[model samples]
Target: MLANGNVLHPRAGRAYVLRGGRIVVSADEIRNADILVGVDGRIARIGEGVSDPGADIVDISGRLVVSGLVDAHQHLDKTGVLRFTPNPSGTLQGAREAFAKYARNAPPDDITRRAERTMARCLSRGTTAIRSHVNVDKDAGFNGIEALSALRDSWADRLTLQLVAFMTPHPGQDLEWLEANIDAAVEKADVVGGTPAVAEDPFRYMDILFGAAARHGKPVDLHLDEHLNPQRPLFDAVFDRVRKFGLEGRTVLSHVSVLSAMPRDAFERVRNEILELDLGVVTLPAANLYLQGRDADMLPPRGLTRVAELVRAGVPIATASDNIQDPFVPTGAGDMLEIGRWTLLAGHLRGDELKTVYSMMTDIPARLMGLGADYGLREGAFADLLVTDCADVDTLVAGGADAMTVIAKGKPVFDTASRPVAGDEHRQPAGSG
Candidate 1:
């Protein structure tokens, strides 16, 4: 029995104690013990027979406790608007056109409503941290930034939301207007971002983004090389800019889908450079799979980065649900486990490979977002955790188990004993989910 006089169960209590669970300290380490969360919302201790008479104990003897999930890339402002704006062609350009049309007429409150719903869904599914890229172009204005900034503060107690000002300039658009708007966005956002591949002058695009980021002392997260054209490669130039600005670990490139189309020798050379530069890569499998490889007539290529090779080469790789039910992805629940499942199948991850796949959602992205030493499930770390029904990673991935309790900073922000059916479990065809 707990100090609060409540029965020991999944929804027992968040009163400073969690006991009798299989705690996953890392991908390779799992221990049966108790976790004591201190008053400062951090893990005070983890061991056997830890007793605290004054604390509320939530017995999870058969449950699996792991770190709270992290989303390295997301689009908060554009979430859950798929029904209003449909992309008939199912291509990148189609998505762009549809979103542009919608954003042109959307008011700030509408954006806030949709974003709030999306974040609520994310919290319900055990996501504790997310890095969202909000549109900063003329159509979106500063509506997204203002709405998401308020949401970030309001949800600060329950979730860590980091905003990146995503500058998406179309062709023939005035560069001066784009740069000025980006400057404004930098003042409001935590990270500076742009789609370099979409810029008419890719180098100049990198210059504007990096210059503003350096001036503002913000990190860079760019959408780079999302196309499958082997002739056009923007990674080298992006790497050169990072080196030139001495922003090695401070830069992240999302959706380098062309890397999967590279030849073996070229891929190896590029992989080595990426490692040397110490850059982070975020593979948005959901959006890439839906948007890319549309023009191929025979045997369309899988639109994904070389995740297996990058993991093998010791490069930092994180996977995310980029767009949720928007014109780009058309379907997503903002669940990292679903993203992990997709990554596993799309990347051909099996056997021992599950460890890396699991890390892509938890530790790896946490590090990339600069969450520091307080992120994981170790003693003396912040008590942000997720307790599920499965005992191991293999079953968690195979079964897509629901997180019974999602704790952030020693507090259970979301918990439910009712196990919802895993939406990724054979609900649709292979690639559709």
Candidate 2:
């Protein structure tokens, strides 16, 4: 397909040949290969010399073609509400208060409009998959679910959207309301999730979520310990319930910022439990950094978990943007690269862990969402990929890439020219220090 390495961007929409690119099958595997996408929305073949005379061919030489990025921890229901409901204090409680007030009056159509814009931003920037948490309570009822569910069905062809019924509790909306309406929410969502740190009894909060997941046979994802105080740790409940509900492989923990401040023994205990349970860990730094550690007078603590240690321990950890232009974060464009870079900074990860960092945005998160089996660049995998303008993983994650030519399920959706500015670019040969 790539004659003499002749380069050309894919122009055909449905089925085509992505010829000659550095195909990143995983964090550690990179191959210069050609990909043939069949009309059935799966990759027909991928090899060094793949070709097809009958199909359209687009040579992507000198570029990096990898699996589409995944944002596994996002609040889609509360996205794009920064202007409508501003969190002037920029604290966790402030965001909760502001959004809770806004949710009471926000209409379903309005939620749909905001979420649709957010999804478009994510898709154009090469995030072809997302697991968004929708707030579910008596106050909002199923409005958030209603909006995201419709969009999920419509965007099924272009993006893989997994909805989590986030059992939420605010000032006016308490735990009772959330418990009462979780069933309806879980029925509409792909996962069962909640923030146990907010509940009066953290154990009770976790039990409710795990019980619901067990009853419905759904995966569980909970926002845990999103604060800076070491004494406020709530991971014990999560570790116990994973075994109690037999949700070891089906459970995911998000925003475990307390791990950063925990004592060594406590940290090791949690880490051991995580490894024992075969759990999925998602560290969301975007909103954590924005909303946590407000009371610090001197050098503030970075609101992130022990990412480097957890990664070194072989834990299935992923990172994502928890909020986008919402009361919680106030600034974000649904860029997974930006989120990855932030994870490295806030989590104090080393430069040699670039591949692992890249995985946090792609394969690791895909695995956390239970899409790992068919998520990456393989012969029979879905052709959900992005032909990015980067020489390698370091250049791409270091912000040296431009717009992405996204292809989802063998179909070229749109070639967008805009992406998030992930600080400064850092490119030094692939294997260099």
Candidate 3:
């Protein structure tokens, strides 16, 4: 044990055991087991009465342990700029205008500093992996990708950051210029991203993006049909391209909020098509809810994708914090739990539905990001887990559940219980104590 009351081995490749915690093995299963992480930073064993006398043991009896959270869709370049750039109209166009102006004036050093702070905040909240979309259009240039690539290497041990090159093109812009910028981004980014719904010609826009991705053999993640217009046919165009390029399971569509306004028959048809294509979907509840449905005169619709329905149809779907404190969404802490809460409320998840909602932030997104088979808390899985003071899912979902310990690759990186607080005794919650 160290001076902080947290037990962590000092030597390299040292073993440790987390004892007597309720481990969440899956969305529908929880077991009272002790986890033994081996010297290789993988789970050596997980079961009742599991023990390794040579390993250091941390007694976490009566605690709840779950896998680390995965945020599949996020905008790291625009994080923490809401105060400086406010969107009074709170519409998608308003956000675009505000951010475009800010990007022109913001320096690379300033962007890096803000992104680093956001990453630290995400780490403290038990997010072990993230897929962040960086701006790659002509206005922002390659500055966002360059900064994020450096940060990804610098913070490799604490967090896994996958950078996606996001191409945001304005109407009537020269396609040749946009294609050249995208080519530069693909040379440096892990994935290629585009917003087909905002393009002047959705088909040509998708053709350019898909052509670039195919030529480079990179995966595609597009922001499709983000508006409230139900008559827009951009989503069909995307499905056609995915089929034509045979990019099934390698493509992801984020923020299909327009589906919420579709008629029942049309919605089912599109949902089935998505399942057939084996494409993944990411819902941005915070940004969509704030930016969409603002023009409705009465009984405004909730700007969200069909989460429950898609999950029921065996479609791969996940939820994420799209914009953190930016012009699109002026409030967020980069917390998956908070995002889960919003999903629960907006998606109408309750009772056993809560389990699927929780998985949206953990297992579902991890699978979408193609995290390897050894991602969860199995025998051969990586030792990335979060131990909270809540003993059950309900308590954790009810809010105020403190993350007691966070382990990244078998190392105790965050210990909330050991942190010194400056406050009265009563102010601290029982779980943190």
Candidate 4:
């Protein structure tokens, strides 16, 4: 404890010792120990009975310690749209129109305020970093772009913000215009995002976009098919181009739910292609689930990408809360734990599969964000961590990381105090007898 209530301070590597918790150093290492987070917000020392007199300490004896979560794919501008109940007949068209209107009418300040609030909520829930796709289509007129850019700047200390400049290659704008604008946008952003669904000739469009990305030395993010019609071959074309350019490990495919509906044989071929290309997959559960099943019958495919298969085949797979109350997804409460729960349940993860589910939100995403070296709980890693209301990974998802504590750069960003209920305090009712 500090002499004052304030958590901010200056010291020569004063140790922060979290005593006696089940420390999840990584996905596999879960051990009971005193983990010391040193000054400058990195793990300095970790072991049993590690003590320091000048150190600040917290007793997390009954909880679990985990690395800060990361959402590898998200949409900052689309996060404030209210959740709409789906209309069986008007699902796709209605949702699209609603979002388009939201994008047009939403003021820049409103977008920035909502995105900042969403980022705070995500941080409170232990998501410390996110790569958000801000729609940069022709109609947005710098409002969305400026808003998202400002959001990234304002929260730079707490979050790792990667912008995907999503382009609109409408007929009037044409192929050449799209290429020129995309090249310029990369200099202004971290990645180049496009929608193959919006283009009449998606193959040719992807070629242009990917080529531009290679030329600009930026990554490629695609809002692939999230529809009931499963015949879109954009993923195939993506794999081919990435392979041809040898841009392995630099491309990301988002919302590829249509791939789930493909036959096993066809999926095998495409999956193999994706693996050979070594491209990354960002599964956005919130948006895809809301957008997909528009024309479904008895069996609605899980709108998630083939995460388990991809991970088993050594392909990098990550998760994101694409929208939080935005037009496309409607409502995403900005909680990654919620996304993890949906992933485990909807993706049929059980037993040991829980570890894989957990990785999607943690180290795996850190790798995607290029922070692998300093992402986790090991010594010399950043002191960004979460104290969860769980004994292990399985229980954490079930309990929703409740009563959690979030630490960023070795300082408490959020802390929840729990009080026992009156007359039901830690015992059975007396009237039961």
Candidate 5:
């Protein structure tokens, strides 16, 4: 560790020291200190009264410095599918129609451009890492994976983008072909993804999905329960498969919206199994609230994954922005903060509870994505960090927090006030007015 005062010369990447910021050293230690970003893109040093004379120092007085946010479940390709209104029926018809339109019409170049814009937007909103799920059925095939893979490579330095290849059922598709496709994706990407609950036989299809993922040595991300009145046994089946394959940290179950309606015992059982398996949970509260409760009777369910109980029980959980304008949820514009805000409101996490909700977008989610070392603002961690206008965690949700600066690997990747565009007078002043 090359250290000078708080000045760190990380091994081989880049180095920039930040001074006088309220440094969050891990999730618990918040102190006034300076940070040294090393050459290998990790934090080289963090201490009080740093005195680096020659190093470049960024003054961050009166601001809060924290780890950049991580969006664990996102559909970057769906941003282009914002043409139509949401389906009122909330049936498979809507999901199929939207998927068809995307399959046929989503141009690769358009996806890359929009995905870039979405990434920039996410960074501007403090998200430094994202796991984007790309559709890769027979329709798009390698084209979808290629586009997303290219985006991942292009944005590697500025932001971390992990691609998940989505597997959907097709007519007469060979099982070996499915395995091959998933293998190709895992070779090129991060995780193997599927929506097994939408399959003709959800349980059997899960066996295929998880088995393939296990074979490829990649994680499994299943779109578990996106609808209300969901088959509660499905989660248990998923956990069983995870245990069977010894894919504990290598599995993620997203959008389990039906858990709010499950009986207490069922919830307890799933929660216990989830903790035992050490599987990650990604709750898309924004999309879930939008899609569910369409046909509710006396009491409409919250439509969120079980967040409080899971967190209280030591189960790792993350929140996500699932869609931009697809048929499932039409409101997202790739904003993880919106998901965080909705999670705070819908999950009833407030005050000190807000800390956990905030971590759902940052530390917890990063750990869920297996990027923990590159996530936090600790020594030897990646220099990737978020500087926020919000003084504390509570205001991060209350004020639509803007990332004053996003440093990726010690290089400044985003700054809200650096570039002043002409005819852009509509921007509000810093902090909520």
Candidate 6:
């Protein structure tokens, strides 16, 4: 809880009227407008002459304001542990082995600290929403869930976090490990997920995941086909289970790198099914670029799935930063703009497709995370926004970490122009500002 004498000394009922800024309301709309934030922390009005007599009116001329970026896929616990765990082989299995060994003894506080550092980086760079996966098998157990769930409550005022209880089938990681821990994990998790593609019986693995999610009415986000094999039995299995379990519009498939290797006809057919099923697809460009295609003897291809084509097909797609400074990719700062820029360059999407790329960062993933009207810049919405010096969305993506201010729930919680790591504090209560 925040004391009356908390450092910022701002109350939750604090109201503000931002004036003269170029607000990017959505991918299709940009306008010079003023936004009035009410005492209840939602946008009261937005127009040319919006005003509140008692509200603090800040002049934001010459600034670009947009909704804070949303990261759909990430690993919070494994972030910032590269030095403690090294993957010399630089393959997915090597990264898994190195991290599993380190996690056998990973204390809860250490996990919280690593997650805190990475989240600070993300928030400072204007990513206010994230869906992070944590290991829930034998070696990792449930320590990560306990640690991050607390952070989820403490940080709710500024950032939205969705936890995925990720099941692993690494030998003994199965058997009694999931049976003992999965129920509790699902109750505490925002989504239930697992690496079904690697399981001995992929259908059985999905049965476990779907059953747990059904028990709690939670959503599903699974990792499958994390390779280049065009044969998509794993994806086919996922589509089948989603249909069988009535999980349509509530399932997300991450790291389906096999989609890139599918034949043109096959991709179109699968894309049509995805459209009908309303399943979400996530592409992790950075980690895939590092881990995929290592076995190729000649020039390596870009390790991402067919991003532009999938988006063109009207599938619900998101591009995200999967691993940050971990054994998975070994390099990242958790910047969504960096992720956006990399997606544009690596996916071979044309510059004219900038609006489509911007949607991945703000709209598509936010909807999947269940953050809808309250997330974006509109009347009656929660006033979480990113104000920067860039003139437009394209400029913001091209310029990595320029000085900016992050506003959460209508209050200026973090201003990079004046401070550092201010968003990391979880001590203050949300209502106390």
TM-score for every candidate vs. truth?
A: 0.92, 0.92, 0.92, 0.87, 0.87, 0.91
Mark the regions of model 3 whose C-alpha exceeds 4 Å error after superposition. Answer: 2-13, 418-433
Model 2 residue runs over 4 Å out of place are 1-14, 172-174, 416-433
Q: Which lDDT tens digits does candidate 3 get at residues 277-366?
A: 888999989988899999999988889988778878888899999999999999899888889888888976666677787788888888
Please provide, for model 4 over 65-136, each residue's C-alpha lDDT reduced to its tens digit, 9 standing for 90 to 100: 888889888878767656532323435456555666566667898888878888898888888888887776
lDDT of 2 by residue, 54-124 (tens): 67667666567889889998888899888888778889989888888888888999989989999988887
lDDT of candidate 3 at residue 424, scale 0 to 100:
32
Clashing pairs in model 6? Answer: none
lDDT per model vs. reference: 0.83, 0.82, 0.82, 0.72, 0.72, 0.82
Q: Would you list the clashing residue pairs of candidate 1?
A: none
- Superposed model 5: Cα runs more than 4 Å off: 1-14, 51-53, 84-93, 170-180, 230-232, 400-403, 417-433
Q: What is candidate 2's TM-score against the reference?
A: 0.92
RMSD of 1: 4.9
lDDT of 5 by residue, 307-371 (tens): 78787888888888887666766666666767877887887675567677777888787877888
How many clashes (backbone N, Cα, C below 3 Å) per candidate? Answer: 0, 0, 0, 5, 5, 0
lDDT at position 245, candidate 1: 83
* C-alpha lDDT of candidate 2 relative to the true structure: 0.82
Which candidate do you rate higher for TM-score, 2 or 5?
2
Looking at candidate 1, the ten consecutive residues that score lowest on lDDT are 424-433
Off by over 4 Å in 1: 1-15, 418-433
Cα lDDT of model 6 by residue, 385-421, tens digit: 8877665776666654345788876777677542333
| RMSD (Å) per prediction | 4.9, 4.1, 3.7, 5.0, 5.6, 6.4
List the candidate 4 regions with Cα displacement exceeding 4 Å: 1-15, 51-53, 83-93, 170-173, 419-433
Q: What is the lDDT of candidate 5?
A: 0.72
lDDT of 6: 0.82
| Number of colliding residue pairs in model 3 | 0
